[model samples]
Target: MTVADAAPMPAGPGEPGFAEAVHVFNSLAVPEPAAATTARTVEQVRSAIHHAARRGLAVRVHSTGHGAAAARPVRGALLIRTALDGAVEIDPRARVARVPAGTRWESVVRAAEPHGLTAAHGSSGTVGVVGYALAGGLSPYGRMVGLAANTVRAVDLVTADGRHRRVDAESDPELFWALRGGGGGFGVVTAIEFDLFPATTVITGAAYWPGALADRLLAAWLDWARDAPVIATTSVRVMNLPDFPDVPRELAGRTTFAVDGVVHADDPVSARRCADDLLGPLRAIGAPLLDSWQPDRPSAVLLAHMDPADPLPILGDHLLLDDLDAGGAARFLDVLGEGSGSPLVGAGLRQLGGAYATPSAPGGALDRLAAAYSYAGSGLAADPDAAAALRAHCATVRTALAPWDTGRVVPSFVEDFEQPQGHLDAERAAAVERVRAGVDPDGLFRQDASPTTTRQEKVP
Candidate 1:
């Protein structure tokens, strides 16, 4: 339902609701971020948060809320929007950026581009930078630079206890690690300072093929991508395109395979050579109807996947794999091929390992997420059951690949679950608890659905 349909709530400066909340976007019928919070400024944020805590209100912090859960707070909750509207500082000399909690990945990229630098941003620029890095951002540049969270220089946030704290590799090593991939279960981050790359652009884009070649194309892609260069960030997607005019005529109304490409920190000649060398096998497998894998501005890297710019309710399920060999390729086709059950709009296989699997610095928290290869589903219709079924299918795929499955899941793509934030398993759970106890003594930030201490039994 639209905000107009919901009952209006009294609000203050930062507390915009109904009318104001109408501008907030949720891919589903969920309330907008404006309706979720009643505060704007840092001081106002603190007051509203403390008031809610004293009154026993559940505090939820959101920016875009891309992976919002099935259940959400309605009363006595404070949603901070300050960071979303401000707090972006770029230091070219220091090669760092300090962004507010609400900053989107796209803005960070644009800001850094002028400085000949780039933040390791996700494919979907609409995602919040703080949220993404907090959950250990796995960006297109991830394979080359490692997870985004590992680049963090410092994090300024308020803990559950209503106290503000700055955490970094040096200040609070343990807490810093847990916050990296543990989600926001520890506290509400207001601002974050992280490293930036000296990259203005790259050779990036995508190539699409007809779905009938799903098996052939995937098999070829698997072989070619297995040993791809670290400079080339690639993904193979199985997409069920709608009959939208905006979609390429060849791909419209068809299930197509895309060999998405992104090349960074490489010369033009090396970049083109890398793309040709890596993708040549896929091209040889079948004639692509649409091939746009040419040089382009780095800022347009999102073109690799060509996802929609608007927000739409989405359900995603993911798992890490050890390999996607020829035999595994056949199985993947059978599960998500032309006419599979609960047909997904999009499916992606991202190669992992390389820089992704490298050991993190001495005390990095995100070093724990296991596995390099990750498979994810995107664009589920607004049907809950349909979404659930898609998730089930992904789980089945994971189980079938048990020997190759890493069991480690990225928080970014685990949104298909009833409670998306609860996917952090046993090992990640213990480390997260120590992070909370050490950094957020009062538990002011709402990182996950439930704090680490309360959900001890679920993991152990």
Candidate 2:
């Protein structure tokens, strides 16, 4: 029977009964799941997809819903909550982590800390391990390690066919490459095994400068970051802070400049030297609000970005540029730094070179792009304009940096696109189509009652 002709299925807990549905996270688009089912194991996850596909329902996966934009959840869909399945295993001998779909980066850090190991994950340890890795994850050691997807050893996924399969370089190579940067559209990734590093302490943290130095400081940051050593990674942030006693006294309710720093190496000594080179020029710009660049445990990974500990809906977007020279720096500061652009909670640019480009394996998604990745984000708010402003600012930065543009958009931050094509490759897009076809050939996975289009009809 056609998806349109298929009958409605039963709903699961917290979901509206088998009718029009919407996906909800802290913010962004909320679409419905394929159907309703409680899943805790790979078999169960597989069964749920089978049943939902039969009933003309769609399925979407969630891991803490960290990077989700308003557009993620599809209506009449099955929501797969990976966090509830929670399992994390670290293999010291192999320096690899066998983690479940629901696991968070923070869990991996804690598990590896006692063993003197660390995963080359992003600044937010609160993010889902699978979701982050799928996005060609950038790292503090990014210049040295490449994107997080580069370190992936294997993946356990429930494909479009309702079959549970393990994919690596040698097995299902095309699907494997798509998964690293293309994201969950291809299938429900239930578990992932990837490489980890040996380290107990890292020299990490950020420093805040007032907006007065926006011009000079940012120019200097761009220069230093380009030549940043393999051990270190940095980004610059410009925003106005709200006055909260909990917020650092110097930064509360004021225009500010921040240079986020990271040093993921064996000891604090080497880490510090790398961090100092990135920060030296900033000292000449403005008085710093906080300079907590010192040796700290891996568990304190959150300090690197100072991303909110509290869960709030977020809208994020990124760009990969060839360089952020003086003119490019001015445009960024003008659009997002001092007062030219709308209110944005956070905005920064990271230098991407070193190990990030030369992974032990080819960088599946990120390698397709040029070099130099820039990131921008904002807290969740009801106003769609906030999302628009964040996107507009990124566009300005992209245009200004077009001279050095390599044309790559990581999936994690590319959700808001009307049609997400530029951010992904044909093979990756084909993989998502294949997974959708194999798993939900009847078209139930689109969430819309219609389910007739190749691109699932999104429930607004």
Candidate 3:
């Protein structure tokens, strides 16, 4: 059986074909897994890893398709689908959660909401909790708390040697560091335990304005961002959304500018005051056609950016930048702003620094963002022609911003396996390699599993 026929697989292996025993969400035509297998429990995962080792087959893992990259090639690997179903175990007293590798943030949010606590989740609620946090999650709440990986307490994984190990600061300190943000190389993570914040209420939402005010709005944001409190994190996007029923009338089929973010405070009253400090100045520049910022449940943070829940064939490019002064901002708007002939569906700048830039105790391999901003752009290319155009436009924007590019990348934002995220510097990468040697001495995972973690995406 081929990749196309894996769906509605047989209830048991060998009943029809062993290939049908696994489940995957993405429908890409390439990178077919040699034999799709499902792991319902930790023992199953360990067994699968051992089988791959004995047969000289590499293991590639997938859950839902939120981490899908249009350009990755998984042609001849054994794909381990970890939809290992389980609910989050939230220890309210300890303010921590042990999330299954297959779990999505939406479920975790639901689990934490009632306790007046929030996980350090990325913008999209559908993102896999394990992969996101392990890759240095850039949460909407990151500025207040550090990167999500910094909060991880422990990880339960099946190492390349097929041994189940619970690694943490005390058990296996080095592997613990690598697992946090270093990318997946040493083992197959089955579950993770990380800290959650005490956020009873938060001020969060999006505010959109007509695209015509691009210049003034961009200028206003540049000035305001400098003083924006660490209590909040935000991003400004220039979008060209398709006209669809789900899209509001004001934004449908129109180019618009929107600033969406979250402000976290201990109490509801404090949250509003901090939010007003940022919004008041922004509103003075140009009134918004849509203002959805208001106090609500902590779960509302997941909706601030309104990321789609379904899988998408996203072709994306990312660059970390130094401070965006007037010069840097002008160069940015020139390419992605009004009338740039850009084919991208959208382009935006996510603010970094604050708690994100600060160093923490017992830090992991991937720490501090170091850059002032992260510039990302992507297009939904359903056809070959559109796909080529999207890549070209990304290169064009990257060239335009070359002067300010820091050449650093965050592991989580690395959407394409072909285009490695290069999350570490040369020295750090070498150190991670040394650690890899310790755990995977023969490089049992070098071909498939290692590349996912060890890709060294370049500076141009």
Candidate 4:
């Protein structure tokens, strides 16, 4: 169909429904697009793209807006919020799922759990499936399953030319590769299909202890993380929680140390053994203030990280790092641990190794992470002053950990648009840019390209 044939117009700023069309999860970094619309169907998405092309407007796309903070600014651009209409369709026999663009991780887990299967979903259920998977998802099961993007089998998107295309390994291998972790900007993804893994139950949850023992606990956790079994993936964090209604009384208004993750195995006995091997030593150091680790359905993995559900102001930073020695660990604690007076609500390192370090066969432009850990720290940005404090603390943490920093990032873990981010090397970035040029020669979606993917200067 011709671009002129697609008839739809988006709402401009201050127009009716514009606010809803541009809703975002991170209140701190709300976008102000020149025009915006929510697309509930592939036809609607095509219409929006055609409208933007006709108007000479650059295009930006988002689903749930969970990554709004990291997304390039949408000023003077047409923003298409994909709320594609569909349910999560699962093929139990094939262990695959066809997830619509706006669908969240919870729905996939709910749909697949009945069949004893689950996608490599992130810690929070609210995170949109397409964005997370396409941006190199670091899941609770990352050590076992690898980057979630590697599991993608197909993608359905509306290119800048207003043509709806389904690209996959068999049909368009290069486009498929670029779509999976190649850093976006190819088109507006309408839906995605990816492989799922068999999992009935998993040992997952968090354990918190008084921050006074953070040093010893961190030491023990690091010792255990080295050569940890592939079946387990975990993270250690130092949290300074506010006294909110949802926060547990014991945890509220305190600086606490925590360790949480998932242990998946073929049998319950093996899962328990792995969980014990991880939690036993930490627990022995001192009595935990609270411990919720136990065997549960795969769905429980989503809640283990305790990510807030409601929209809120947030500012943060992230890094991929080499293995930490005692000095590195001490530096981490000095900035984010007890008595650091850090304004960040939470800061920590996610263990990375096992399958995460191994490149997938037929993987995308961005596949494996060579680092040993993923470090992230974030705080609530309630106002200009609070935001400044958070940014300052983020810089402090960054400086403290610079020695071990790999100077790379997992796109999904990146928290700020200004954060240094480069998941692909020069060769891969050049190749991704070539694919983008082929699909969007007019640069209609140029602003949608990640800073690391396109040669064009990004909008600050």
Candidate 5:
């Protein structure tokens, strides 16, 4: 039966339902659409699309709204906030998982761990699964398993015509390719099925030292990261944490350098050795103020990064960078480290190599990031003046590191819509466009495309 046959209408602006439907994780980028609705099933998603088509409204899709800041404005559109109803289905023997849209990584981790398996999930367990995986996710296990998008075996989405299609490498290779990391705009994804890797326990956590030791720590970390093992994925950050009850006393209101990541292997002994190889040199530089690195179940990996649980106004910038030499390292610390007087709460580089540099056998549009490290800096925007200051600092940092910038980005890491974001070359982008045009001929989902990947005018 078609949605046109029978379905509830969406809520217009100012309606109670509209308020609930437009909820987002980033307070700074709350969407104001012409109409909105929550879709808990495929039938509801089809109905929302049919409604938008009849009203001549463009369609936009989001789940947790964690990437709301990076998305194009939803003005004059009907936003479909997906909350697909279902439990994560795991196939232990096949080492695969089928996750419904609106589901979070925490649930998947819990489900997979029992079977001695885990998916390539990001640091924050609260991030929606569909958006992260589809946008070429950079996981705690990324260096070992490659981008999360490569693990996708199939996708189920409701396209513009209200047709329910399940595309995979065999059924429709082209669409499947574009859907993986072609910068979205395909349709409302209902569920995703991806391969899971065998993992039970892993050594993961964070270690911190005073900012005074940043120079030595930074140099030592870069040297180690250049030849770091594939079994370990780690990052170093300079943080200025707030004084909160949950925060450790030593870290609050102080500039500190931190190193955190995951180390996995077939046995506990090997995992410990991998952790020692990376942490030993830094420990020699100075005593740490706080250290939480330890062997634990895979679920502990999420807490190691320390992403906030509540929503906040965030402003930031991202870049995929080539190897940074001594000069580049000095430039980075000059703008964001110790005495830089930087407004950003956190700024650092994520180690990217190993599997990240290798292409997947049957990968999607964005299968791998060729860069050496991912740089990101962000600050809280508590008010208008603070927001402007954060923007200026982000630009300052961008300019300082321009020499090493690869002029590319991973869609998942992009924090703002206005940042220079591009993951695909011209040839690949054009190819993705062709598929988009075929699937959405009338541009119903055009606004949903990432500005960097499409020829569309930049959103002002």
Candidate 6:
């Protein structure tokens, strides 16, 4: 649809939903920033960036806040809230999509599903497409296709100098390379263009067992996952779901372990075969209380993980791990499984490798995740006491897994802006820094954002 067809949204602070707009999806309830502006069009974004630069004030850019820091990251600078006015446009012939920065993955999936095409979207449909794609997106198909940054074609941004430029490989080679994985150092991105794949469906879903069986199920899954095809991706999660009307009756207020996976293949028959092979071992541990694995649309994969639709008071931590042997898997389970009394709401291990371990041509600042798996855990922290306990427990979990730690961070998994991390090596990071200095000479963007910061975790 065209801009004329879309409804007009609020363009500034004090308008309806302005106060609610400052709240992120994580439900951190941070204090409002010093200055805030809403943008419904690209011109508005350009104006905000330009004005902030001249005023000598810092600027912070955000859309959905799905990956935003748990603490307040938007400070004294102007906060550019982009719910840009437009619909996603797809070109079936070219297998490309032009996504508005403020839009979510659900909108893009709906627009592309009819044509049997899909972008490399992250697991949550509610996540902002631009934020995920720009920060080196890790999708359900990451093993087969690689990070979403590998598919970027172009980006339209407003620089610190207030220049509006459409950059691609041929238009501006250096800027294009930096913007793909360099995060927000360059400028406020208004929109992006990316490649779409041919497959439209996936054989995917999740299977669950009681927490008592978490250890055995984890052991079986680790063995099976080792030989699983690159066309398949999976993760194992140990959860303590809350008792809420919205939650499934079987899962609510119960401790459970689940193995979720997806298989992307050319035909339904082949897809089912691959899924069966992946699920065979886990079934031996016990009959799962719930099993949703089956053939369906690619969008269905997003629902498999069962991430909360609304924001909650949450804090999280994650680490990358090298490939492990049978003994290593046992040690992992011993730390967080049965009788451990871990306070974490959910602790998960996502399988990684295949194409994700290999860099694609013209790779951006971050080309590959050097580890074979990712370990992530989080807890609800609604008050000071709960917050301190959650923070301390997260450290304990990390200490238990330090032996296999890769000592590197995954950009998309890191929501803590102050967390120490190294997403790239010294050489590539230096290159990205050079580009930032070139375009933003006055250091105006520095006041706005510093993705290069390796700030240590705060003592909350």
Best by lDDT: 5
Candidate lDDT scores, in order, read 0.68, 0.65, 0.76, 0.89, 0.91, 0.77
Which pairs in model 5 have colliding backbones?
none
Give the TM-scores of the predictions, in the order they appear: 0.87, 0.84, 0.91, 0.96, 0.97, 0.92
Query: Relative to the unseen true structure, what is the C-alpha lDDT of residue 348 in candidate 3, on a scale of 0 to 100?
Result: 91
Q: Tens-digit lDDT track for model 4 on 279-344?
A: 889999999999999889999999899999999998999999999999999999999988999999
Query: Per-residue alpha-carbon lDDT of model 2 for 39-75, expressed as tens digits?
Result: 4566666666677667656666665665545243455
Can you write out model 6's per-residue Cα lDDT over 35-128, one digit (the tens) per residue? 6766777677777776776776777777887766633356566777778777899999999999878899888887898999887888788999
lDDT for model 3, on a 0 to 1 scale?
Answer: 0.76
Instruction: List the candidate 6 regions with Cα displacement exceeding 4 Å.
Output: 1-21, 29-31, 70-72, 447-460
lDDT preference between candidates 2 and 6, better one: 6
lDDT of 1 at 273: 81
Candidate 3 regions exceeding 4 Å error are 1-30, 70-72, 267-270, 448-460
Task: Give the TM-score (vs. native) of candidate 1.
Answer: 0.87
Q: What are the runs in model 2 whose C-alpha is more than 4 Å off? A: 1-25, 33-38, 70-73, 84-86, 267-269, 363-369, 384-405, 419-421, 425-460
Could you tell me which residue pairs clash in candidate 4? none
**Ten contiguous residues with the weakest lDDT in model 2:** 448-457
Q: Please give, for residues 1-460, the per-residue lDDT of candidate 5 as tens digits.
A: 6653344578888886887789998899999999999888889999899899998999999999999999988999999999888999999999999989999999999999999999999999999999999999999899899999999999999998889999999999999999999998999999999999999899999999999899999999999899888889999999999887888999999999999999986587878788898899999999899999988889999999999888899999999999999999999999999999899999999999989989557599999888999999898999999999999999999999999988888998888998787888777888888899999999999999885542333322
| RMSD of candidates 1 onward, in order | 5.0, 5.9, 4.3, 2.6, 2.3, 3.6
Ranking by lDDT: 5, 4, 6, 3, 1, 2
Question: CA lDDT of 371 in candidate 5?
Answer: 98
**How many clashes in each structure?**
21, 30, 1, 0, 0, 0
Q: Once model 5 is optimally superposed onto the true structure by TM-score, how far is the C-alpha of residue 447 displaced, in angstroms? A: 0.3
> What local lDDT score does residue 135 receive in model 2, on the 0 to 100 scale?
70
